[model samples]
Target chain A: MNLAKTALITLCLMGTTGLVHATDPNLARNLAATCANCHGTNGKSLGGIESLAGEPKQKLLQKLADYRSGEKPASVMHQIARGYTDEQLDLITTYFAAQK
Target chain B: MQNRRDFLKTAGIAAAGSSVFGIAGCAGMGKGSGGHVVVVGGGYGGATVAKYLRMWSEGQIRVTLIERNTAFVSCPVSNLVIGGLKTMADITMSYDNLKSRWGVTVITDEVRALDTAKRTLTTTNNGTITYDHVVLSPGIDFMTDSVGGLSGNEALVPHAWKAGPQTVILRTQLESMKDGGIFAIHIPKAPYRCPPGPYERACLVANYLRQAKPKSKVLVLDANGEIQSKKALFTKAFESYKGLIEYRPNNELRSVDAKTRTAELDFDKVKADVLNVIPPMRAGDIAARSGLPLINDRWVDVDWITYEAKGVPGVHVIGDALFPAPTMPKSGHMANQQGKVVAAAIINLLAGEAPNASPVVMNTCYSFVDGKNAMHVASVHQYDAIKKQPMPVAAAGGVSPAANEIEGKFAHAWAQNIWADMLA
Candidate 1:
């Protein structure tokens, strides 16, 4: 009868049917795995490359936005940042930020 | 670090209002969804998949990797070895880490046959092994017959494409050549392994000859009309070699005289002291023999979302073996990315969950034009729901402004990190 109850019912139906609601829970984790090849597994880089794990999510997102906007001067990240949607970038940065 | 318990708790909370709405736990949830996966050819793709399967599965999924070579030698930087900048040891890595650290069963054996119906594979020495899912990452096998007299005479004219003995042999051939002698390299057509490899080999070889044998000349005989990758940068790099390096386009190899080290082209006969002929390539031998559907009778066609060979259940193929979506170069970086995708996909499938619908894979390929300077070409590909394949993002990735020392350092760091990413 109420909006909160209706929303809860919709979420319950989606979860029970194995449909993703809002976002796939594993999407952020999977997206962040892509950066592991260069930045290190879980973003803890080994060599000269910057480590992304545990960095503030907003900081990471801002840097990525700068790279996408051509405001940040990078050898490779500038070109790489333009590939993902804003939402995907948000999820990836959140996932990496959560990594300790 | 969201574990299965956390995921379930969130699901439970969402379903609390109704007893009728019950959440079914994924069998693949938590550690050890418990399936045996046998991966063939432990190169970039196979090794990464094998390691990631065991890792992401928390040692629950059994992973057995069968590779022909005992050690892992990277083809990415093998050009430097041919150019005499780096040695064979510098590019070679061991598979011990994959076995000891990751609990992977690493076998140095060649895969002979794939019994898709039974979900088993027969190896050269390891015998037949059954798997819930089988991953084939057998990299490109050269079409040696494409070049005349190139099949058995590899000792005379080494392709050095696979980055092992042939690499050393090619380097040795260059070392053996006298001053003012010609060292000719023949590149096969595009869509071969490592698009920028041939040009990098040319630059490195020229770099070697410039200092070691200044009088000697380097000749590149290419099948394609233009440079395959990093054209402008490679073109400019070639200019640095000026009279030392000569690049001929559209000159496909008709044949070769192995005895005299002479190349018989359509228009010209090139005589060289050392002839390094890189033949056109196809998916490895086992892949071709496995009866999977192939594109152009060369690359396997697979569903990009699952990396599963079309119509072939329980069998997945990745790396250069798959028919690339538009503009997807078959490089190690792309292969590693594909490995992770398949790993996550298999994990989800084993757990009865859906694969990631919005999968993304990107590539960063760096080529050394000289000993200390390199340039890179990068692109990112996201799954297109309409096309049902990963398409490159427009206005996203591009080549370097110019080759520089900083990029060269990054290239080295890329190698170190990527090697560790796959093996360590």
Candidate 2:
């Protein structure tokens, strides 16, 4: 990555971490809730879609990372994964991982 | 300890100021106490916000959803019903789950007036309701007056946009059309509800006609220059129907003859056996009458992060009602995402806490090109702190390579999942 692009990503990571701890405690849960429309409530999908509930945090993070990197092609997830910062993705996966 | 009076006082003071983005102090309720929230119009946006508020608050916040319709009728899969592939039951769902399971108080009444300063809403049937915050998600309403001779003739040329009785009416009209008859559907200008919806309807209708009435032709009289969404895919889908589908660009509906079933454009006038005109639209009537600031005198102007109306304090508007950000389509998926953002904001604001600094929302819309084949357009938008709006992520989000049956199944699954996400 170029220096500017790398610097931008680093700044985003620092900003995300700072905001999550300083502002809303429910930030992770709120971010995860945005996925409920297609994925189901708390990531326990109803049917026809993969459920994210109870998945290991590392596994979920790896899947999201792959999607962001375009390594694991998806119909929608690839696009969605690129929308979040790395810290935001970590929080979302952690939230879903805790869900039963 | 703050009481209900103190809470109202703080809200009123905050609302009266130049900015009402943040209200001060928690309304000091005891250990198990929370405030009440009133949601207007139990559609995709309204229902999702109501359920999320109740769930996140853990029953501390009381939620009352006031909607005119008794049950939830979805617009996503309603096109399949128009094409005769699905029934109304398939697109219809009950709001009982929101009541019984999510603990939302569903009131089947229309909101007549809103007092932003008093933080109260008056319904047509029920008495006035006071709330700590109010959310309006009334969707879009047609500007029938814009099209001459079309104001009171909706029964003759049904829009079927809201997906209830009008859907059934249009379906019945299609069913009664002769084998060789021409069914014409009109498309309004850009920035209408569901960017790809009109084209999908044309495809489904043509799909039905190709099988049942081979001699019949489908005319798509579009006001815009080209297809608004998934252009290449829809263009390819239209080619599959061959001579059965005719697409006309910039042929806006200036007027209509309801009696003769004729559409009057600037250059030509065409008559059809079944005339379907999707008229120009604005924010729902309730949003217009609530004294909220509107953009282009149509859509409500709202803050991207909180979905809060620009000038109205403690009143957030979502769904098709709000003037969308750059490249944001007025879609149910986006509305539900906005609903979640607003839900989270309201919860924090009610507790005298700051709302989340960075929020994310995305859209995934699947449109069926035929009975068993579908295509999709997906986009992801993140809150841009510099622009103060959600901008589309570069090098991300795109349309499907081609129409396929895999996405067809995913389309049906999308409808079922989204309906449950809002109501259930």
Candidate 3:
């Protein structure tokens, strides 16, 4: 009886772990859509806008956070950034920084 | 196969944790996966940084981009849109090409805040993210207050400088004006984006009037005694386009009564049926609020060699936001080149490798004087590490084609190629 209970607990933990992992890619993709507007389809911005396709993830995240926290203060951007949560920011940073 | 699955699983967990709590993980150690990078702006400088970082790093870097708009409407060619030769859609771009072809992540969101100390970024809807490096390419902000009566009244008098609805508004006003009515175009002092943009706009508007409303004329009000960039070519074109357009030099616009459509200049007041007021500019508001070093209204003072901020460690500035050596006109081409150089430096810094002691940069500025005639200027530059600035490369390139046929053809080709290089 004791052995069966332990096995059941272990299985539940593994299943939860797999579930968490499965959701990351989708989360990242969803987050990336928000950035496609000015940056090109691939992270390149047309004309004078800069490209963010293959930058380092951490650097990208820091800058975004800075802008949101009033460390950076673009008039239009500040108004635009007020809608996100902490998790979406990470998903976006990791996804773009990981591009080839 | 199981091992591969397990590795992906681990990487996913790590990425999630890093994004949520600002943690660095081992995902970067995987085969050809350097790490994740996210960029906030998708402008010329940002796009170049993203593209080259991916190219030079191979599959080691994964790039994600976040921006607020759905399409990129270029200010560079937006004037053409106003001239009626091009449409706003013609200057717009989607991320489909960049994503499918380049393997980049594109997020269409507004970045709200950045925690540089924590290396984390947050968006209005996307949540939090941590990055190893971040590049900002948000463009200039107009100083509407520079001219009194125009303060806080974007709706009353459109600046149309950003190439979106403002461009459309300005164009519509011109289209609907009376035949023999006066259209006034104001040009500000130096250090504005696209030094030749306002002048190009004047020529295009003049061309439009020549065929549609021959009696209509354009009055150019200049803040400086002489116009900057491709002056000789523009002067010649103006002479050819005369009668349709009139030029006024050393005429600074002081105020505007938008209700009456009247503009007060330093020397005189001009009443017009239409007004296109291009205001003075500064680095976007975010740069100033962030406490980044500024030369007057600029952002991110840096050593030209490394593109590293002078006082701030690990921060860099490029594009119209930075103070480049005098004579370096702020153009998209210069911004792209600067992006590449800065990306290289960042990659080197990350790999624990030494950056090139000296870097070379190239710049080109092309102006479409009319549908057929175009002029350009190209120069190569070398960085002086000791002086921490750039000096021109001797005789590598010069102004536009010496021959007429070459100039005309090159202008067309240059426009196509530059657009391709920037977008495609």
lDDT of candidate model 1 versus the reference: 0.86
Candidate 3 lDDT, B1-424, residue by residue in tens? 1233354444445545454321123222122335566766777777666765676566467777777777777777677778788898887777665577667777888777766677677788889977776766767888888798998666657778887889899889889989998889898887788888888888888888887888999999989789776677778878888788899999899999998889999889999988889898887665676566788755557678556556664555678777667466677777776776776666554543334444556565657776666666666565655666877655344555321444445444444444554446
Q: Write the per-residue lDDT of candidate 2 for residues B1-424, one digit (tens) a residue.
A: 2454454444444434523122111122111237888999888899999998988878788899998998888899889999999999988888899999989999999888999999999888899999988999999999999999998999999999998999999999999999999999999997799999999999999999999999999999999999999999999999999999999999999999999999999788999999999999999998889889999999999988788899777999999998998889999999899999988888766755456667788899999999999988988888888999999988778888999988898887777787888887
TM-score of each prediction: 0.92, 0.91, 0.72
**How accurate is chain B of model 3, given as a TM-score from 0 to 1?**
0.87
Error of 3 at B228 (Å): 0.9
lDDT of 1 by residue, B1-424 (tens): 3344454455445455545433222221423457899999898999999999998888988999998888999998898888877888999999999999999999888888899998889887978899999999998888889788878999999988888898889988888899999999998888888999889889998999899899989899999999999999999999999999999999999899999999999899999999999888898878789999999999999998889999997899999888899999999999999999999888876654567776899999999999999999999999988899999999889999899999899998888888998999
Candidate 1 - CAPRI tier? acceptable
What 10-residue stretch in candidate 3 chain B is worst by lDDT? B22-31
lDDT per residue, candidate 1, A37-58, as tens digits? 8898889889789999999999
Model 2 chain B: ten consecutive residues of lowest lDDT:
B23-32
Better of 1 and 2 by DockQ: 1
Q: How far is candidate 1 from the true structure (C-alpha RMSD, Å)?
A: 4.2
Cα lDDT over the full model 2: 0.85
Against the native complex, each candidate's DockQ, computed on alpha carbons, is: 0.43, 0.23, 0.02
